[model samples]
Target: MATYEDSKSPEGPSSYPISHTISASDESNTNMPSWDSDDDPKNPYNWPTSRKWALTCLAAFATFLTMMNGTMATVAHFEISEVFNISETSFPHSYWIVTTWALGGACSALFILPLAEDFGTRPVFLSTYLVFLCFLVPQAVAQNYATLVVTRFFAGGCAAILANTAAGVAGNVWSTEWSRSVPVSLYILGYMAGSSMGPVMGAAIFQSLGWRWIGYMQLIWFAALFPVYYFFFHETRGSAILTQQGKSKDKGNDSVGSEKTATTSTSSLRNLTASATRPMILFCTEPVLFVSTLWSAFTIGTLFLFTQSVEQVFMEIYDWSVTQTGFVQCAIVIGECIGWSLNFLSRKLYLTSTSRNTEVPGAPIPEARLYMAVFGGVFGISGGMFTYAWTSYPHIPWIAPAISLTMVGAGSVLVVSGVTDYVVDAYSHYAGSAMGAVATGENIFSAFLPLATFSMYNNLGLNWASTMLAFISLVLSLVPTLMFVWGKEVRARSTFMNEMTEDGSKRSDDMV
Candidate 1:
């Protein structure tokens, strides 16, 4: 029998830690396989710079495609409604075509992400992507609404893996905080950009090729990339790699315990269950996490809500055609790009604050991450919403409301990014569970918030409806500032944070 020992949790070591491994055998002295050194080629963190970036870009592009699929169907809602004999009064039902995609993503992530952690990212990614593509075929040729909705649900479930795991892939290769931020930001850009561009692309395609081609184009693009993913994407999870090494070393040895088998279904199930539950547990128990996630979720939810509201606002107030309305989404894309660039400024502020804090020389001050969110919430989201609401009139140039979207987009990106960075820094190794909590809230908001689009616009009118959301956002926007002011005190009070600190101390002591 082979026994493996390491101080790190089964999820693997922290990004900064030195690699450690030890082996012992009951019947003989044999060296178990492990990374040869910190510079081992088998370790993703040691991969060449070019190779690391290539894979990161590949993962980012994949995330873009999956996110785009969620909203590319937005422009075609009218056509889909017509084809299915759905009435204008049934707008909410037709909206489900888009909503279910997000709903599926939300529900499926709890299970899919856990599976990726237990297995390896490469296998789970390839397998889910294959399943996603299979489901896409039905959407292209579906004869009934049921087929379309059902297939999209399953497809979105599969697509969730890419959006959630792409950043993890980037983190696998770049272990440093600042360097890792670049690729992580790239992935975040891909996500926001994809959502913004989907309607634009869908409109052009719908104008020339019609609604069916939207599905066809997705099929073609996803299929073409399948080969790229299969050929180039490699496993990045460290624990999964180590487990494989252990299995290869012990293969064909009957004395090896069943519990030691890396692929044992029983252990995998336990991991999956634990992974699925921990996020919710943390979410329920952690006040700071709950507030931050709720704020971030509202911003994300607003982004999705725009898929419907933007079209309606422009078509009604600007008298713009569907194609013209689709182009308006470009403003959001431009804003997202600007927001991406602004992250560098946030990083600079973070570094400056860290340098000034002599209490812990190299420790991150998580509150510094909230600066962007403060600017974004106050100026970007709230200010933009107020501007967009009042300027939305046929008498007012469409450009006014359109430009306001830039603020909304920029603000949304900043808030989401700031909150994510703070969670990662504050929670440390438990960041995954903290993030899982955030993702769940964000997805749920993305899924359900849009259901009220038409009702809100029609009942409250554009001015009040927009103002209502803006006010809500204004209130939520205060969260980041509050966190920035009291984050240290808040974190000190957290049970999860204390546990993380204690565990980290134990690991350091073990190393000493």
Candidate 2:
């Protein structure tokens, strides 16, 4: 199949020196058969819009399910505490379930994506979801808390790929920078909405049936999607496709066989090792990755922190039932909806701003992606934190805090989409590695924030603890602002990003 770059690039004048355009007699002597031209029917980018959307929706659903399962036990916190005979002195034990899940996600970010790149996304994607499914039974029928927690850890590890790799899938489908926003926004909505809605569903189920049903629900839902995904999702990895093409050609021709084999094996081994270590190295070396990941980490960590504590606040301060508290968390879903709507406007702004530059391949400014994040960080995140902190008095109407929750939700989505898009634009072919680095930071911080939340509230009180978060948000707000202003310089200094650009350009030329 022709590469995504082929579909996105102009067909005639810009696609210079295409190899497939050789004469019929010249083509017969070629060492390997590739797509006939840039318009190859088998190229995923050339696939019908209906098929593309189907693939995207399935990927998004998988992402939603991961978060749903991760947060399923959240609203069941009280029930689990009671079942395990946990005490206030051992309160952190209750949170260990959440922490362990995050730990698994963090650990998986280091290796799962590398495996995907080495093997192929289809098999790795299928295997992880199946492994995640197997862990659910142990969680649902555990004889003790230890068994439940251990199973949750493995489930989280398996599910981690959902969070990190869905964006890569989105990148696989959408070739142009302008085409990425809506699909990426949809992906973010799935993640944030599932996270918020999970607690709500868990609250109702735990209240009516029991905590065990939460696992059953996840299992049932995953079981339904597994077949849909396995049957419909086509392979989108370019290198994997090329390797298969080479293998197919080897049966008919022997001249290029040894050279192809040696090159393929060596390249595969190097990519595997690089994918395994690049994220870690980038976290330390790349300013853009470091700063963006830190900002993303805080936003996501704070989201998890809120997930753990929001129920406690509503129950105590408003004297609300579990069902009532669950309804309140719907504010997050509302916020994500609003965030997604705002993304449409932001995308329009992006298209209009970059319209002239689209004719020039590989030159879309990464800074453009951060503009929405600026609005989101300052008003959506900082403003919401302050509002929630100040308006949470027992005498205050519950609506006040709910309104604030919307801002937090909106800001979280904006930052996620913005930074993710920026990193992908800046890194191009190495997007998965850069994103894995960011996901690692986000998950690691999220794992620890729950432990800090209870103490923060105890020592600082609800309003003050939240105010502290607001202050931190205010400080981190500069991330998007700085990136917007100076991102070009940051990209200029990135050796990895430069390497990817050079490598991508070479691949684009070779495929043509």
Candidate 3:
């Protein structure tokens, strides 16, 4: 005879049958997604630990390589400026390195992320990442400036799959509450390694090899990570993957997206068109998603804006050599690493609290992540900016503002991790679509900001320019705060968020 609990407790089954003994916890219990898929023994969530960690490492590696491509030019910006014969009055050409890639990722995420619903993660991911690598070949060997810029933008477009959707993969792959920490650590570690690698690695290469080899270095990383992706990364989306596996078990119809495609075989063309346009429709129509995207985009824009502008401040004012300049640049990556570490700790704390309070439970508010958002806003952007801005003068020791640099970098970590975690939690279904919407703005701001950074610094001077951008970041940080506090109400009012909040919304619609 099987046993069941008549009395409810906050914590339920620790094993396969999560549905068998679920506690009636939060008021939004009416809107919870089916615990059925979540409890499926055959689900990827139930995969062996070795397999899951393998996949996590693969994502970490791939993410590292892609990010390196994103920031490879930062340390080399001075050399790149001279090579292009750009005017002394404007070194805005440097912005193209970051902005174009951001724009590309934004444009592609708009459509690609939503495709997980129809196509599945593995198919879309392998296809996009492999194809994106081709553009780098031309970029490394480009004869003129225009060609490199255009190809970089196209490469960034392909990166949308890797960067935007990786988090969702992390969320979907595990069952433990703080399982997110493992992936977050791996991802952040890869990110810091990549960003820091650009300068330290670049300095070494410039000393012995050529700057063009920096692009080739990415190719080496590509070769190493590609096989890992092919063999290890499995489809982890709860709805699409599980539904298909369920079909194999049922001996009935094909999976959801499969069934739709098969039935509409004669009109496959029409089906594909409709599916492709879904994210674009989501972008224009949704409110909760749009707001989330706005916050994500602004955060992205500010990060790149700091990247482009900071190099000049260090080089011109402090008179640091390329290698020393790169060390100073370490503060950004250090800050991000610190931010991720705190987030990891915060997740662990939440888990501990949940474990202790057995009778009473709480809904996982998106704002649970917002405390870090506040830190990122106040310290990372505003305070860090002020510290760096007010003291950027040549007279003061360089290390003073340099120490403050870590705050912004660290704060940025919170901003990114918090918004990412919150939006995915709040709008689980359309997290990708919402991300796409916001990324579109983010990449645009990132790309466009560099175009004017030189002029702004020229006219405003270092102190005022840093102050101005700091103030802008302070104002925009409120966006996330409002969402965290009132996001539930906002989601209730919007049709877009309705899809994620309601139980019946189609799960197979998300892109991998």
Best by TM-score: 1
Each candidate's root-mean-square deviation in Å? 5.7, 6.6, 8.1
Q: Write the per-residue lDDT of candidate 3 for residues 186-305, one digit (tens) a residue.
A: 565564445444565665665566667777777777767778778777776544454465455556554755764565353434534543564467667766556655665665566566
Off by over 4 Å in 1: 1-33, 257-259, 262-266, 358-361, 499-512
Tens-digit lDDT track of model 1 for 439-510: 878878888899998899999999999999999999988866776566657767887775443333332233
Ranking by lDDT: 1, 2, 3
Error of 1 at 411 (Å): 1.0
| Over 4 Å off, model 2 | 1-33, 251-263, 354-364, 494-512
TM per candidate? 0.90, 0.86, 0.78
Candidate 2 lDDT over 260-341, as tens digits, reads 6676576656665766776688788887788888888888888778775686678779888766777678898889789888
Best by lDDT: 1
lDDT agreement with native, every candidate: 0.74, 0.68, 0.59
Model 3 lDDT-worst window of ten? 13-22
Q: What is the lDDT of residue 453 in candidate 3?
A: 76
